[model samples]
Target: MTQLPGSYESYWMESVAGADHRALAAGLEVDVAVVGGGIAGICTAWELTRAGHSVAVLEADRIAAGVTGYTTAKLSSQHGLIYAQLLKSLGAEGARLYARSQQQAVEYVAEVSVQLGIDCELERVPAYAYAESSDQVEQIQAEAEAAREAGLPASFVTETGLPYPIAGAVRIEDQAQFHPRKYLLALASDMVGRGGHIYERTRVVSLDEGKPCRLTTEGGATVTARDVVVATHYPVFDRAMLFSRLEPSRELVIAASIPGEHDPQGMYITQEQNTRSVRTAPYGTGQRLLIVTGEKFKPGIGDVSRRYEELAAWTRDRFPGASITHRWAAQDNTTTDRLPYVGRFHPGAKHVYVATGFGAWGMSNGVMSGRLITAHITGQELPWSKLYDPTRLHPLREAPSLLKLQASVAKHFVGDRLPASHADSIEDIAPGTGAVVRVEGRRCAVYRDEDGDVQAVSARCTHLGCIVHFNDAERAWECPCHGSRFATDGTVVQGPANRPLEPRRLPTGTEDSDR
Candidate 1:
């Protein structure tokens, strides 16, 4: 097998020595049960705990080890020319509310880190959305004007600190970059100190909504709470049909150690080259970690391994003398209208609230979600609550994007069933790789290891019955339809899909003879 450079683990996860919390082993009751232990859940739980509400956070895996740990960790409100679009779609007042909520999150993180004495390496830096192409210059200018109108400290500029040149840029100051895991882990610990409970490796499989919502874990442990916040990144319980409203995309990230003099000194992004985001974190003495993220594509679609290469090449070419030290991927969901759904889970639900679809700017948005959801549960009316309400109907604005997303999903669901999408026979399968092939006229996801051992699982995704595609980069079966992922042996990796893929046994005659 060809060796891949650097570790597959996230740099944030590797840098911090995290403390483990036990999984759910018995049933319990709390005032609030927060599902998902990443940024949103932990922040929500922490806020609730501080508010004198009994809260318990149930995590499918380790706290902050999921998407939170994999993020670029830029805590800024400059989410790539969004103010201009928000001004058009949501109007001036709505855009102002959006800016205020996000800017508050940035300030909130700084305040909390200082109050709690958590050295999260929070640094105040300017953020920029630059135009690499001349055609994008006008867009940048419009964004600058729109952002300033929305009350953000934004301005249009032609010069930046990037090694390469730019046409125009929208610069926003008083933003920040930090170590998310360190910050979140500290918050998790503080939540514990405040009598809040955290259970790791406890996956909630079902939710029974009522006056006091009930959640059942995969291990059969039960949690009943007066209110529930489904902060799961993809939302495990999608009673509101978020699968259609939200679109999932995975992006590649590469980090390299650069000399202190080479640090970018600020956060930057460009829509050119698919999507490029650049930021830096303090590393070992006199060194900085240059984190570059780009090559956004639908999960489970296309050549992810090649996308990694393309991102790496872009980094090497842009930052000379920088050696790639770590590589990882982060997945995010974008809503039809581009703003996150952060209030009530659905129109009918009374006790269930949801926070998802932050696009690619989860750091600030996640903090915003924590505060917004807390206010909702506590009956504190917030100015921006209605703006982020999941039930808000924007038919004219959302219809086009929603329809386009559903069409792509329908194509994947029905189109992948065709014969051409499958391999001819197991004999053609290569070692250390996986493919969907037909066995006895049934589609099976088969993988042959380098040792010539074979394993097969049903190709159907348990979430939506979409065919699973093998991701060579991650060595997992990914559902292109809804972003559910499973290991080659069929264990669920990420969700929206709660169950593992069923195992399949190949007929003896169909086995490759070389094995």
Candidate 2:
């Protein structure tokens, strides 16, 4: 999920793939062609199947391999600091509808878990949006007021079992959590068995969101469907200018499984800047304590190494007995306002639906999206569609971020063409350090560390042949376009690109081999 190793990394993959019965080739058309197999896609498929519509899901990877598996899996009505902010920006009516939709989604998850006999360890619990200081306590009051106006049982909580001090918390009862992968896996099985098609490793190159949406695949297959759902994490086919309207944020999660455990039975959330949330789930007969969640950082913006260390220290101080088992990071789409984008991709296109920009609480909300969109596509009146309409324009607080991203993408694509050699020379670089070098004919990027060694890698990124920039924080070469990252050792860390940075040896021999 985080594109790195963790405790459940190997076990999680084997377990789900063994049970999933799906094919990879593109076949006949269906009522809906869902582009992603994450929780949103599966849930949508489930809803479509129940509605007696045939749906086909084309996934770039296995189900739950995207942001869905990477999520913190909290099905809470309390999206931290959301309702309060929404009330201020979008008014009481907007806030109330948003809260109702989210809470209803939470209830539906528990309802469906029992209905389908899905043993996802679903459990109801209390959730807190508390402040650590008295000044911040007013935040809880404001939030509670908004929640009440929204017809919810919310209040200020002065007391909590956490060792840390807090002024107050806004408590929302009956929020839930579960193993996300388990639930999605079960849904995938049901989708497959009930005539819904899922294809793994089948990346959608583009989607024409026009009438009778035509989806083109990277492998030269076309699926023409009456309707299409673009649930793929970022929706590469941003025909709706979603990137500007919706921002991408990466979150870090580090979990330690306690040897002996007693679950607190409720999800706890703090109102700090970079929020931290905790919950207890079953690892086996013995319960596992998971201290998850942190806040948003644009891709490759913050220091990556610091992410792990901060969480490690946080766990060490909080639960001394718990031994670390899994540590990972996830990225999710966020909107400027608190609501998610769920409906038609854009007004220009017909019969294409999408559910994206879920903030970080997609387990319940995403499932609700699947249900609502499927209903609308099949010509049914879903109760919440008007409120969560994808094209609804809220206040443009996110306009700055969106504008900056578009400008950057534009600048990088043009700027990357100039050879890196135009800037630096080998003489300008210290030994054991790397620099872009200009020779008689070509340009190359060279790296050397304190070890008095030299390594050369192609300055051009594999994705679009644009020159790459070395990220000192991650010790990897980062592509300015699309956020592809490669380690200093030339291994691919993240993708859109499946290949590593090209190795450039010295004219005589391989420069890195000397090491």
Best by lDDT: 1
lDDT of 1 by residue, 140-253 (tens): 999999999999999999998899999999999999999999999999999999999999999999999987789999999999999999998998886799888999999999
lDDT of 2 by residue, 196-310 (tens): 7888777777666656778887677889888988887656565687655655566777776765334555687774757778776767656565656675465645355566666
lDDT of 1 at 162: 94
lDDT of each: 0.92, 0.71
Instruction: Point out the worst 10-residue segment of candidate 1 by lDDT.
Output: 1-10
Given candidate 1, what's the lDDT at residue 492?
A: 88
- Cα deviation at 76, candidate 1, in Å, is 0.5
Segments in model 2 whose C-alpha atoms lie over 4 Å from true places: 1-23, 209-211, 259-262, 271-273, 395-513
Clashes of 1: 0
